[model samples]
Target: MSSLQSVTDDTFDEVVLKSDLPVLVDFWADWCGPCKMLAPVLEQLAAEQEGKLTIVKLNADENQEIARRYDVMGLPTLNLYKNGEVVKQLVGAKPKRLIEKEIAEYL
Candidate 1:
C-alpha cells in the first residue's frame, strides 16, 4: 500500500493545517499525467520522512474548494505548510532528490 495519506476537503483543515509536523500537500488530479509520475516519489518521501514530515495528497478535481483556496494552478503542486500556513510551493513534476532539496529545511 502507498504510504501517502489522502486528505479530502472535509478533513483538510484538521489533518493538514493542524498537523504538528510540517505538512506537504500534493495538489493533484486523476487525469494529470505529471501527478501520476510524482506519486511514487511522494510515496517514497512519505515513507522515508515518516514522523518528521506529513505528506498528503489532495485531489484537485474532487476537492476544488481546497485547491482554489490554496491557488493551485497546476497539477502536482506541492505546498509545504508549517504552523497552518504555506511556507513553500513547488509546481510540476520533479525528481525525488530535487523534491527533497526543496523541502529539506522544513523537514
Candidate 2:
C-alpha cells in the first residue's frame, strides 16, 4: 500500500503537475479540525488507489503560493488534477465513499 506524500511549493510542479498518474492534492493547514478529520480517509484512499491515483498533502500555511494559485479558500480542499489541470474540486471533509464517488469518473 502506498502512503500519502507531502509536497511543498517548490516540489508541487514536479510532483503533482508533472506526474503521470492523476493526483489528489489535499490542501490543508495544521490547526484545521476538518483537515485532521479527513486525513485517515485520504490515507486509506491513497493505499487503495495506489497505481490509479497519487495522493499528496500540501500545507496551506506553508505553501501559500501554490494554495493561492489553486484558489484554495478552505481547508481540506481536495483538488483532483489530471494532465496538469484541475479536473475536480471537493471542499470540506467528506466521507471516504463520497470522496471516491466524486472522483470516480476520473478513475
Candidate 3:
C-alpha cells in the first residue's frame, strides 16, 4: 500500500549506492512532520520517473548509521547518489516541480 519504496540500513548499498539509475534517497523519521509532508511529492516523482530514477526512503530513526554517515542533520533530507557517490543534497520539504527539476539534471 505504500507509495514509495522503503530502504533500510541493510539495503542502503544495494539499492542506493549500487543502483543503475540515479538514486534519490529521502532520509526521514516517523515522528518528523516535514518527512510526512514530503511523502506525496516523492511518490509522484517515483511514479512519473520510473525508468529515469530510483527513489528510496530511509527511516532516520531506524537507520541511525546511514543517517549519521551522510551527516543528515535534518529530517526529510533528500540525497541523490550517482555512481556510488552523493552528487546532491536537498534538505526540507520541497514542491514537486522543484524536486523534479533538480533530479532532471542527472538524467
List the candidate 3 regions with Cα displacement exceeding 4 Å. none
Cα deviation in Å at residue 55, candidate 1?
0.6
Residue 32 of candidate 3: its Cα lDDT? 89
Better model by TM-score: candidate 2 vs candidate 3: 2
- Taking every candidate in turn, the Cα RMSD to the unseen true structure, in Å, is 1.0, 2.0, 1.0
Model 1 lDDT per residue over 1-107, tens place: 35578999999999999999999999988899999999999998888999999999998999999999999999989999999999999999999999899999987
Worst 10 residues of 2 by lDDT: 1-10
Number of the top-ranking candidate, with lDDT as the measure? 2
Ranking 1 against 3 by lDDT, winner: 1
lDDT of 2 by residue, 1-107 (tens): 22578999999999999999999999988899999989999999998998999999999999999999999999889999999999999999999999999999998
Ranking by lDDT: 2, 1, 3
Off by over 4 Å in 2: 1-3
Task: Give one digit per residue, the lDDT tens place, for model 3 in 1-107.
Answer: 35788898898999899888999999988898888888988888899889989898898999998999999999889999999899999999999999987878897
